[model samples]
Target: MARKPKLAVWKFSSCDGCQLSLLDCEDELLALAGNIEIANFLEASREVIKGPYDLSLVEGSITTPHDLKRIQEVRKISKFLVTIGACATAGGIQALRNFQSVSDFISIVYATPEYISTLEQSTAISSHVKVDFELHGCPINKEQLVEVISAFLFHRKPNIPAHSVCMECKLAGNVCILVSNGVACLGPVTHAGCGALCPSYNRGCFGCYGAKENTNTSSLSNKLYQLGVKNQDIQKLFRSYNAYTPAFLKESKAHD
Candidate 1:
């Protein structure tokens, strides 16, 4: 029989939510296990199988010197590397510190700043290594995660959408909160994945899935300003879950 493709899941400096998304795949995971060799997943199993893994699903951003070295090693051993969630793909919520002084925060938050050895900024995996694919979301949509793994297994592109959350809102028949209630929303430029969850309930999107392809954040920001959203509030809006992503980061900086 042919050897099952070796799969590995790695964590750097994230909440481990993305890894849990895989385990949450309960039924599909059981079927996946039958076909793939889960080589190294500390959260799922303590059994450390050796690599050169065929595919690696990586979570979290590079936040320390150790993270920098470890990711290079992981890349060297894995034939295909896919970054999962906001942390791994766009530096996550922690990337908010990229705008401020890390040393000052460390001195205030840590009793001993000298003991804390970290990089100046939290950065995505792609910032340090060649990433084959990037699955964006705060925790990631479990269905999308499965599709990404399956795509790799089958040697095809993942069928994830590059459309904006506004498309999802329209498809789900959710009323436009921005137009009707003059609410400040990021849905116009944010990626579609969470099924427009917030807007479906009459709330605005927080952009947990990062920016969509060719996002016109400038136009969206102008619209928010017209809706009475203050410049500072607009800045904070873009600097939430996927702040460090280029599209959102540039827009956030413009408002600053």
Candidate 2:
């Protein structure tokens, strides 16, 4: 029989939650194992295998000098490289360092700042090498991960949408919590795929899916202000998980 396609999973500067989502796919994982060879995933199994991998899934951001070099090597070995989660695709929460001084942050967090060696800012994998696809979210949605992987394996296009969460809320028949309950939401500007999770629980969107394609965050911020969200609160909202993304950052700065 011909050898199965090899798959590799890699991590950089991240919380590991996105990679954990893959493990969370308990039943689907076994089916995936049957279709591909687990070549080099450090988070799951201990068995090491050489690569020239068919597909590589990367999590986390490039935050160190070594990480920059390592990602270049990973790209060379990977036929198709997909970045999973906010960290790999949009520089994660750690990327807040992009706005402030790294040394100042290190001093605040650690007793010995000199002992720590970190880049001034954390950046996404695309900054280092070419990424074939990106799965968004703080920890990506499991179903989306399955679809991206399955598409690669079967040579089909992934069905991931680049629309805003407003579409999702409408599809789920969720009452507009922003209008009905007077809650400020990022739903209009945030990417869909969390299945309107927060709104389903009567909470506003936190932009976990990152910025939607062609976002109009300025309009959303204006609506939020009109809904009585204080300017400081508006700033705080955009400064959450996906703060560093260009659209969110620009809006947050305007409010600030």
Candidate 3:
């Protein structure tokens, strides 16, 4: 008999929203349970079996020395390692710490700053280990999460788009907010996945997903400046969610 493949999920410095996206699968998770042994998922099950896991879904950034060591161990055990969400793929909102001193941040946030143990920068898992795939988002879209896992289960590439959110906005028959309403938006450079949700509601994209491939943040920043968006706001715009992603980071610094 062919034994079921074992699945493991790990978390580091993150909000755990991406892991919740797995639970949010609700129905798909039930069907998925039939095919694989969910060996280690603290959020879904506390009974952690030892691993040389077949597949591992790792969420969050490496924010501390402990996480750095832990992820290396994870890479050793998992045959296939897939990093999920902006935290794991590009570093989440916490990546803001990368721009400034961790000591300064800790002093402001903690009354007993001496007790806070952390690294100076927040970084993606791929920065530390060889990742097979990366699924990007602030809190990753559940459909995309399913697609990633299903692809792994079938030993095939996931059919996830590499296009910008602007493509999704056009597909939804929504007018370009930047063109129609004179709003500053990241849709032109942000990745497609959330189905252009914010733009559909007549709001600008906040780049919940990371930068799309071939993103032109310089051009987008110029457009925003033309729209009378403040340089500070423009900086803030790129410094949120997927802040540390190479494209966004470079553009954000250019504004400084």
TM-score for each of the candidates: 0.97, 0.97, 0.97
| RMSD of every prediction | 1.0, 1.1, 1.0
lDDT of 1 by residue, 99-166 (tens): 99999999999987899999999999999999999999998999999998888878899999989999
Question: How many clashing residue pairs appear in each of the predictions shown?
Answer: 0, 0, 0
Model 3 lDDT, full chain set: 0.93
Put down candidate 3 lDDT per residue, 98-216, tens digits, no spaces.
Answer: 88889988889999998888999999999999999999888899999999888888889998898999999999999998998998899999999999999999999999998999999
How accurate locally is residue 118 in candidate 2, as Cα lDDT from 0 to 100? 88
List ranges where model 1 is wrong by over 4 Å.
none
> What is the lDDT for 197 in model 3?
92
Best model per lDDT: 1
Off by over 4 Å in 2: none
Candidate 2: residue 214 lDDT (0-100) = 100
**Candidate 1: Cα lDDT at 51:** 98
Pairs that collide in candidate 2 are none
